[model samples]
Target: MEHINQVIEQLNLEASLTLEEIPQIDLYMDQVIQLFENKFTESKRNEDDKVLTKTMINNYAKGKLIFPIQNKKYSKEHLILMSLIYQLKGALSINDIKATLTGMNQKIIKEEIDLDSFYTSYLNLTRQNVEDFKVDLEDSVKDVNEEITGDKKGDSPYLKQVLMISSLVHMSNLYRRVAEKLVDEITVEKEEKRHK
Candidate 1:
């Protein structure tokens, strides 16, 4: 329990770089990896965890999940796209991620919003929700713990932990499904507007 509390505290302290904080100058692949490693050092759970990798970046480009690099250098837009890919890869397939990003990429290409502005808006929106999300997560964990404790069926502690994890996984999957649907709908709506 103490360890769990400590982890939560650490998570609350962790912060991603804001749009303005990201480097404005273009970076080569190795530089991009180094930058991410430095920026995300505090957030890494273990030495084995990857921050970013050359192969991953190349794979993303090959998969069309991100825009093509220019002169083998990544711009701020590429950094933003890489960040999104890193976060989304946990719960979404590469194809799904590509579908979700395609609309935004089109908007960027059309000068609807620059990369910095797009990332800034995303940061603002997520920052607004961060506290609320923390509260909700704490509440959910407490509720699960209380419910498990109240049960008198003599379930083992390990089983209780498994049950808690399963419940959380289910909730995460549901959220991901909803998010995918929402992204698809938004993309369709944008396409309709473009064609009209």
Candidate 2:
């Protein structure tokens, strides 16, 4: 329980810069990398791990996962796009991310929405959902722990840990599936619109 609480505390302390926290001025590639590294320090597992790399950034631009840099300077919108890709890459495929970004770019290009507006809305919703997930995870962990403690069969600590991990993995898998479904839906919608 102490360990669980500590983990939760660490998670609660983990911070990502809000859309408003990102600078509006255009930044050079090195500056962009440094900014992401500072903001996402917790995400790196080791000192040697790169948070954002120049090669990855170049690939993202070339692949159209993010907007093209102008005069080797990335704008706030580019930062926002890269941030989203960084967060999603762990759970989503590059194709799915690209499709979603394409839809967003379409809206932005059409003047139906602005990048700042979209990013602000995304940040607000994501922050709320992250808070809710934290609460849910804490409650689930406590409930699992209590159940293990109350078991007369004398479950071992290993068993308890296994059960807790399994439950969390199941929940994570569900979220991943839902995200895939959403990507598919968005992609199809975009395709249909393009044809019309």
lDDT of each: 0.77, 0.81
Best by lDDT: 2
Candidate 1: residue 168 lDDT (0-100): 74
> lDDT tens string, model 2, 122-154?
778877887897788789878887888899585
lDDT for residue 36 in candidate 2, whole number 0-100: 89
Write the residue-wise lDDT of candidate 1 on 12-99 in tens digits. 4346666766788999999999988888777777779888888889899898887778999998888888887877887888878888
Supply the TM-score for candidate 2: 0.88
List where candidate 1 sits over 4 angstroms from the true fold: 11-13, 155-159, 186-196
Candidate 1 achieves a global lDDT of 0.77
lDDT of 2 at 194: 86
Report the number of clashing residue pairs per model.
Answer: 0, 0
What's each prediction's TM-score? 0.84, 0.88
- lDDT score for residue 47 of model 2: 71
